[model samples]
Target: MSYQVLARKWRPRKFAELVGQEHVVRALTNALDSGRMHHAYLFTGTRGVGKTTIARIFAKSLNCERGESADPCGECSVCTAVDAGRFVDLLEIDAASNTGVDDVREVIENAQYAPARGRFKVYLVDEVHMLSKPAFNALLKTLEEPPPHVKFLLATTDPQKLPVTVLSRCLRFNLKRLLPDQIAGQMRHILGAEHIEYEDAAIGELARAADGSLRDGLSLLDQAIAYGGGSLKADDVRAMLGSVERGQVFGVLDALAAGDGQALMAESTRIASFSPDFGSVLDDLAAALHRIQLIQLVPGYRPENHDGDDSALISLAERLAPEDVQLYYQIATTGRRDLSFAPDARTGFDMALLRMLAFRPSDGATPAASGGQRSAPSPQRSAPATPSAPAAAPVQQARPAPVPSHATPALATHAPAPAATPRVADAGGMPDWEALIQRADLRGPLGQLAQNSALRGREGNTLVLALQPTHMHLAVEPMVSQIADRLSEVMGEQIRLRFIGDSQGAAHTPAARAASARSAAQSAAEASIEGDPLVQALKREFGARVVPQSIKPFES
Candidate 1:
């Protein structure tokens, strides 16, 4: 007897034996038991996801000599014949080979006859979406209203290509892709029954490589068994699959977190010896980083993608900051995309790793490899000396922190516990407007309103604020009332407030003054970095260009 492949030998003979796809199985079983079967049935899903398999099982359920039940007795002639693919009443048609209208017409013409050896004649059309438009049109009416003695079982990977009219006539069952654990469990069952020696780890590798298809997983298992001389070993499977082991992947990540370039290159060399796909290596790196980030954020959160203790990932999460992990993941993904364009795979991979180290945020707040402690300039002195440029206009800004122009009006304020509230100064009995706004701790729409309004002196306990025409929309009653309330609380007096709307032309509001100050600081930071002697020397020697967007204002 010829040796049969594992996929074919272990083919599910009954719905109960089918792995995963419980949803499709349950619906079909209920339909069959109730004797409420539809005349036409459509099974759709991706390749090897059991679309055609379920169709055949349903056919057996309908024609089983044991008397039309969901569970067909294997001893019965009808069930056995269907299992062997030689049942006289089951017409298996490959729609891909015969997609013309003539073929559809022949199928329709044959519907008048009854089953030759069973209770119902079943027409199984595989890849039904391959049929031409005219072919579908010719069969639509007949498919919708087939003879009582016949049943149509149509299977397709691409249901979108089939006309909606054809789709509406059938009872559609979508089979879901099997998860890695499900496929691994099935592989273990087959190996145990076959009396083959195997490691659980080897089975896991095969399942992941299968990419959600049980048939593909079984086929890979067969090849792996043959390759391993009838015994599945983890090492042999990893070598045969040309995949990098998790240990090697973790080593690369360790080197990255330590900022050890030499260790990273050494690990890369060792991994390249297996001739593994560099792009896949990058993917592994990114996946590991993502898991590390999840662990860091959601304490005690373990992902199901990999098996066993991920203590290394947890350790890395503790060692590295969340921002660093995110930055590395982003760089790895971007590198994978650009790998094909590189001169070689190793070169691309190396550059991507290097870029991750090089492009870390300049802000001291973000952690670095040097023990998460970075030295930054004091807040008061961080902004560089601005170039002497003529001032645009005299804009008295009460608050230097600029709220964005498009920000919505916030009705109240809720400052965080650690935030320091600015002290309200008397300033010789004339309320320092900017200091007052900061002291009020106004946020949201109220913040934006105060940020954009100019302080026009107070008269008779009524402080009048001037608003530019562009900002008149924010001068609403609710926000104005909150501003007055906050001011009253801060100044220790119930000062009534009134707004002078749209009268001041091009007058600088507090937000505009803040924006101008920020622009100047950004310019000075960029100029200082660009003018550095070390930076100029590096640019001349290595042809390194500064990334402009990476430059942000620093406050000392």
Candidate 2:
């Protein structure tokens, strides 16, 4: 005896045997039980999701000899013949092959006659959408007003192609694709009934490969059973499906968390040897990252349900910051779509990895300082040397402790600290207006303006700021309020800021250069602290680290 594949062997003999799609089943069962069947019924869904299969079952139920019911008795001659595809009253037509108007006209002519062997004459049209428009028009009248004994069951994967006129005459039921868990459960039942030995993971792999189609899943299972020679394993299924193992994904993620570029490259090389699809690898990476995000957000996520090595996955998830995991997921998802245009899969994969590394927080290196100079306070002065002639005359000095920036508000009206004193010009006047503006701290769009603008001294209630022709055109029109606020804060006055358009500029003086140098050093030191390797390692390993908002540096 030739063995039937599981798909055909376990095909739903009755509505009870159908795995998913309860809605369609219920509607048909009610129609059959109540004797309220429509003249024409349309079953629509993706291939292998049971559009055709349900049509057959519904046809059988309508003509079953034991009386119409949700659970038709298959032993009756009518049900048995329909199941065997030999019933005279139940005709199954392949609309794709016989779709001309003449074919449909022949069916219309036949519909006027009585049933040959059953209570109802059922015409099951598979892929009904393939019928020509003219064929549909020819069949419309018979479809709308068929004899009481005639039933039309139409099945199509693409119902949109069918004319709306034809659609209005039929009762439509949409069948949905099965979920993975549902498919897996059904496979377990079928395999157990067949006494075939199989691993759960292998079954899961088949379910995922099927992508929500039960028939496709069964077909894959049949192939897997043959490949395994009766017993199936997860590794065998992975190889058969050309799916990347979950462990490799974890390894890549672990390397990323550890910031080990060499380890990442080595893993890529190992994966390349298998000639695995890099696009699939990226997809798996995205899945793994998604799982990690769930773990981070859910508080107690477990990876035990996953079929591959999950220890590394859990470890990496625990180590990497949540934000980094989200970023990696984004990059990998984009890389998957861009893989086809790359020179090769490996190049695409490597470029994606580089992007991830580039955005990753620096381990210890400080980013380069940007923006302009800031004024620094002068050094404290010692009392003038005693005029006394005695050798080793004592020199008195006023040494002031460094005051924190936050402390300045408490003494806003007091004389400035000695170290906070602004630079004085020769012959005892404020520093040159142009030089003063050059020494002010500014950043972002404001910094660009300062580099090209001059200062026209303080007025009674306003500090007049001047810009070069190019700078004025660029900065004078907008951003006036922002410039005013920054200037007022720096000069410690209630002076309003106004920009004057001019082309002249001034170079930084010796004092301004010194101040700028000092400011750059301070910024570099702060950046170094923020990006320290030790701090980054702490963040990765424990999933927590000090951020600017969460912690402040201690004052010495």
Candidate 3:
């Protein structure tokens, strides 16, 4: 006997054998058990996502020897015949090959007659969208009003091309692309039943490479098993697929976080040795950054089990700043898009990593400096303009670090006051939080969030903030962490944040205070304008009147 491929050998025989499609299965089960099944049905989805398979199973259920049921006894003659694809009543059609009016007309003509071997005749047309307009039109009336003995099951990868007249007459069930985990689980089940040993990581790599298609995954598995001499190994599978390990991607990030240029280049060179697709590598990096961001911004967010990537992701999430994570994510994705334009794949990848290091948020800007002393700039090898200074002369630091070329907004942040001389509270009260926010020069949405929140007081390591109930929704993950980080730097202590709704309905926030001050200034300016002696003289001499709307305030 010849060997059968895993995909064909392990094809789902019934609804229970299917995974990741409970919604469609439930609907079909109800329709069958309650005997309210529709005459014409359409199953639409991407390739290898069980569109035709579901249709076939539904056909088997309808004509099972045990009677009409969601579950059919496979031993019975009718069910066995359907499973064997030799059932006289179950007619499987491939519209891709026979897409003509004549073929559809033949089906329409045959659908009028009763089933030859079962209670109902099933017409399973795969890729129904391939049918020509004339064919679709010819079959419409029969499809919409097929005889009670006939059932039409249409499957297609593309349903948009189908005529709406035909679509409106059938019950449509859209199948979903299988997730990587779902694909991996099914792979594990098949490998166990086949008594084949496989590394969990290899299964994960195959599942990801499948790109949401179980059939594609199984095909890859077969190739991988043969490639590894009948055993699955992570390194072997990666070599076969030419994919970089997730650790190497994480290593690049770890280097980026530590601000180690040499280490970053070393990791890049190591990855380049594999001669893998640099674009896919950058995609993996971007995906890792996305997960890190979710961990950082989403409270109580659980990480997905992708062959033990959770712990490393969590570690990186804590090591890197939220702003830096977002910046890296953007650069990674755009870098992948612009890879073709670069001189070479490796160079493009190296530049992307180097960019992450170059435009770093805290290259020289620490949360708090000691003794108000900036880190001395590295010695320049270039000759000075005058060429009079000695090489041993101190490299004086007089200014903030020069902004990196092509730096993004995320890289610009407040350089907090020295930790040696932290800002202290006055009169046992909050240290004029509004003034502190201004002095620190917080920017962007984080600044606005701080301005809108009034400091209530502190309890232990946490600070209570009074915010309007309406604006409380703005106090989400990123904003909360950013504000806390900035404040802790200025206060010289780690502070957790807690927000409470301002029930008093009073304007106590910095924004409200600033608005009140502006209003007062405007009123004073308007009064001064109204009482001007020159204006009064002009009005009297020309019989003119001051325009109330034109009494502007000199606000700066």
Candidate 2 regions off by >4 Å?
97-101, 297-304, 308-327, 359-435, 438-556
- The pairs that clash in candidate 3 are none
What tens digits encode model 1's per-residue C-alpha lDDT throughout 365-414?
22122442223222322131111222132222311322232122111122
Best-fitting candidate, scored by lDDT: 3
Distance from true position, residue 320, model 1, in Å? 3.2
Instruction: Give the local distance difference test score of model 2.
Output: 0.68
Query: What C-alpha lDDT, on a 0 to 100 scale, does residue 388 get in candidate 2?
Result: 20
Give the TM-score comparing model 2 with the true structure, all chains together.
0.65
Lowest summed lDDT across 10 adjacent residues in model 2 is found at 372-381
In Å, residue 454's CA in model 3 sits off its true spot by 47
Candidate 1 differs from the real structure by a C-alpha RMSD in angstroms, to one decimal, of: 15.8
Off by over 4 Å in 1: 97-105, 303-307, 360-556
The model with the greater lDDT, 1 or 3, is 3
Q: Which candidate, 1 or 3, has the higher TM-score?
A: 1
User: What would the per-residue lDDT of candidate 2 be over residues 200-251, giving only the tens digit for each residue?
Assistant: 8888778878988999999999899888888888888887888767667776
